[model samples]
Target: MDTQKLTIRLPESDVQFIKRFAEEHKTTVTEMIRRYLKQLQAQHIDEADAALQSITGLLPQNITEADTRRLYADYMMDKHR
Candidate 1:
């Protein structure tokens, strides 16, 4: 795959820390950043999936027209109370 170059400015302390971390891990800072980004993306996907799962069964299926009307009526009544 083709790759592009990116330039970023960091504080001297951060740069030193990243260099030490990369040396300790036997990986380049670029690879470390890429791994971190992948982790962040995975975390977001997990959170979104959890949110969708939480609402999956909030409403019942197989409701008739009468049931729908009754549900709406109850909602309106509760809203006004």
Candidate 2:
């Protein structure tokens, strides 16, 4: 994978601990941080998908275009009130 250099500052003690942890775990500090960020990205995608599904499930199975427009118009009217 393509990678770029990123610089971050941490307390000396924290940095030392991370180095020890990485050595014991057979990985690097950069790898651990990358995995953590990937987890957050995955969770965000899952949450977004769930939100979309909930909205889609609210509508009828055979709703027509006219019905959709009417519903949207009603929602807009209520929102402005």
Q: Give the candidate number with the greatest TM-score.
A: 2
Candidate 2 per-residue lDDT, tens place, 1-81, comes to 899999999999999999999999999999999999999999999999999988986878999999999999999999999
**For candidate 1, what is the lDDT?**
0.94
lDDT of each: 0.94, 0.95
Model 1 scores a TM of 0.74
Worst 10 residues of 2 by lDDT: 52-61
| lDDT score of residue 25 within candidate 1 | 90
* Candidate 2 residue runs with Cα over 4 Å from true position: 75-81
Sum up the clashes in candidate 2: 0
**Clash count per candidate:** 0, 0
In model 1, pairs of residues that clash are: none
